[model samples]
Target: MNGPEEGRIRLTVLGGYLGSGKTTWLRHQLHEGQFARARVIVNEAAETPVDHALLGQASGLCVLAGGCVCCVAKAELISVLRKLCDERTRADAAGQRLDHIVLETSGLADPGPIVAAIKSDPVLVYHIVVSEIIVAADARHAMSQLRSEPLGRRQIEIADRIIVTKVDEAEPAELTKLLSTLVSINPAARISGAVKGVETALPSFEGVAPDALPDLNGQALKPPVAPTRLQLDDSIDWTAFTIWLSALLHARGDDIVRVKGVVRTPAGRLLLQTVRKVVQTPEILPEQDGLGEDNMIVLIGRGFTQSQLARSLRYFAGKR
Candidate 1:
């Protein structure tokens, strides 16, 4: 559907491995009324959505049962998103406006395809923009899970932010190792700890910038070491950047877990992010001097060398 609407609905995809406390974190958010004006889409693998039931008294909550939204129920997800947007639009005319959308993917679900579906769909593209991918990692089991399950690693790799759940139950050293492993897998992501009954703010990516994209060259490879960050000296050609990024992600999405940055384009400052192969359409930011002029791009991945990544990004640099 085409529209002249001014505001796009912001979306956050919550995902993680099974038993990672995704539902527990979500329940906390709901009880705190953080999603008071948000339409929540709950995807469950079973015939009935237990998560939806647990979220009692939550307005605008909808369920897509019997399958994962990232795969089997993607079409239903699209339909539900459109319906939510339409309903909110009508509701706004009557005085209540929905502020955002929170999609709770089944714990075992891969969020890449769900993100792709939102960006590629003709109708949803005009209405929704994914803000971030948040994954809940169990502090006690994450390391073991990562060793055995490729899915577990992928979830960590794609996250923009990770909430380390069950922190209170984990031993100090185990928590340290888990956090370190998380950094090794996806250094671009911000890691936070969560415990039941202790309130932790629902992680948001708004106005957050990479702390230090560390250069890994000649350094002893270690867990929790920072990933390399590349800053272009000049504003990039948006078309050129898009072309390069699309090709890069298509070719190495599995290895290159998370990519996010702000860039200055002829049109404006744009926020760009991707999780694995699912690239979000760039969102325009307010025009301001020195905004994204640094052309900072942070890349987090495994197995690839720094020189290789540097070589790939070199073309995007403006002529000196």
Candidate 2:
């Protein structure tokens, strides 16, 4: 979405539910130079943000956190966009002028409202054009979620393109059911598969029947998800921590939706993450000095408190 000469910055909005791999997909796209010279904005619902650490190579990067951009943080997003437009307008003609922005929204966001906000803003309507709304769907968990999570269904319906992520990890039957369900939810949106954020061909399941999802009410009906942060020291045992995580997920996978953070060890900085009960492979990040959020993990789920998380993790780390 680049109308460079007209000074209107084209915007692409990327959204997905908790742990849907939007960050992974966006990181791969950035590494592949898919959006050259485009500014990247990451919206983190949690106060302690780590997603921004993965996308370091963007032309410009900013993190918006502490609220969901589609709801509580809508005004903040608009203000940032306006600031970008002002900078671009005043930029010297001899300097490089970026004309595109990719906004990676929080997992809990609804794209329809965000889109409406952008279109209705008098100033933004002229300064920015929303080129696409791309949503990433988790192949393993979407079938069950679309049936229960109203936000998930709305995301699918509002998307211009749907990227079914973790295709290789999910069973073929489950992937098929998810794909068919996505079609039933938003046949107007183009759908494709991605394994580890790399685009891949989807297998044909022509006769497969989509899941019969119920009519979910608004987001208020579901239990609220809040982030709980756990601080770990560098000397903490990674092995013990993993064991603790496995136990926690086994007991509360339904409630523990996401776990993500950067940790330090004998090796380089490691990025740890999990979606539900599925633990993603840890990634080694390029060392950055004075990173405050390191040695901390943020768990997003319901029915848990920060003190419980702290006590559990501390005990597991042998800090009796």
Candidate 3:
């Protein structure tokens, strides 16, 4: 393979389905200094961004929320890339030069469109070279997602690297099935595994049976999944809040694909998230004074409304 041109900047597109652990994997890589001197750009579907808070290790970071870069936000992405290129051109110090750009796409985005946009854009085409597309696929839910979601299938089909995340929690047989399916769909793509963002070995699926993926007519999708932001205030009682969340997940977990929140409490800042019905243990984040986005929750799913969620939370907390 030929090396990149002298002044061109390499951009890596990290993508995956909802709750597929894209941030987790990217965080680990940044911590390990894999992408040295790289600038990170995060595109989130929710207006109130949460995932970007965890990626402080990047050399630089920019967040674009409330739009999917593949469709709704392509122009914004191009503009950002052009700005980065201009900055690189203007930098004189050796340490100030950016080695690469890591764009973390919204979970709902289609990598194909994003990739196409960069290569086809008149200005971006001259300044940037797309390095690769790294996609993270959830092991526990890959089967169902691939079978039904056209967007999910497109993400996998175009990835250069497919990371099967949450491997430790997935069933062995099902994991094998997912591996087989991924290989069947994208034979040229390299496959690997990760547990809670740490790299691991993928078991051999030499003869495992791949699930028969149904032919989704592209329009047969369920209602589009969107992010609903909810506010958490000091007036809310803790016990009632727990009950409300438990009840909400219990009733609508299938419809609610991902839940992520960063809230401030007497103890410290807590990062809480869940994928489907599985609730992950909360982790404490470093204290930051006057974090504006604190006490906010973003639920990404279909079959729900913003007012309905806010009302339910308020009712359970006895604040309404």
Best by lDDT: 3
Off by over 4 Å in 1: 1-6, 197-320
Give a tens-digit lDDT track for model 1, residues 1-320.
Answer: 12444478889899997657776688888788777777778876644333453455466778776667887788888888888878878988887777689988876588888899988999888878888899999766677668655678889889999999877767766676677677778989988888852444433333443323233355564342123465654745666667778888899876665565666677766666565666756667654433122366665556666567667666654432
True-structure Cα RMSD, model 3: 1.8
lDDT per residue for candidate 2 within 1-320, as digits (tens), equals: 33442657789999999999999899999889888689999998888788988888877888998889999999999999989988887774758676799999999889888889988998888888888899999888877778777878889999999999989888988888888888988899999988878999998979999888876654346678877788887788988988899999999999999999888877778989999998988889887834338888889999989888778888888887
Residue runs of model 3 more than 4 Å from their true location after superposition: 1-6, 92-95, 289-292
Instruction: RMSD for all candidates, in order, please.
Output: 19.7, 2.4, 1.8
TM-score comparison, 1 vs 2, better candidate: 2
lDDT, each prediction: 0.70, 0.87, 0.88
The candidate 1 region of ten consecutive residues with least summed lDDT is 204-213
> What local lDDT does model 2 show for residue 179?
88
Tens-place lDDT per residue, model 3, 127-178, is 8888889999999987888987888999999999999999998899999999
